[model samples]
Target: MPTYQCFDDLQLFFKENNIHPNIRFENMNENSIFSMVKHNLGISIIPEMIIPKGLESIKVIPLELEQTRTIGLAIRTPISPAVKKFTEIAENWCRFDKNIV
Candidate 1:
């Protein structure tokens, strides 16, 4: 997993669950992770929306789990119309899905 702040909790969860990979690659960015997966350097669990261009051949497997991520929508005061619409949609979707936000 990437060495992102979001992965901190995930790492702890993995340790508690005794889920360890043979060769783990941490301290990498999302782009590097995607490149590694594309070139068969390693495998990653990424969202479909973030997949880079020209990696259509890669296989996709959706895992169903009861995991939740605390998400936030940061917007400055006096938000634009578009941002307000997006925020509303996002919050509604987050409320609907238990594993997100």
Candidate 2:
């Protein structure tokens, strides 16, 4: 099994499996984390959004597990008609991007 630095479920799995990786206590926002991984300083678990470009040296193997995050829209009370229209437009935009109705 490949190692990871920051997946919550994967960390639990590691504990269950009694396999400990060289976990560095670093957050993903720091560029050093990517640098370290690229330099083979250590392997890390990063979100897909932050993966760097031209990383042929690094391999991004996909996992079988399915994961998703929920996104929400919020507005202040007494939403105006314009705001409602804008919200509809935004939803349409997102639906178009996803090719969904």
Task: Name the top lDDT candidate.
Answer: 1
Q: What is the lDDT of candidate 1?
A: 0.69
TM-score, cand. 1 vs. native: 0.59
Model 2, position 92: C-alpha lDDT score: 87
lDDT of 1 by residue, 2-50 (tens): 6665467666667867888665777457888876776888777554445
* Tens digits of lDDT, candidate 2, 5-63: 34666676567667677765655454766666678787665555456677787787654
Off by over 4 Å in 2: 1-22, 77-101
Clashing pairs in 1: none
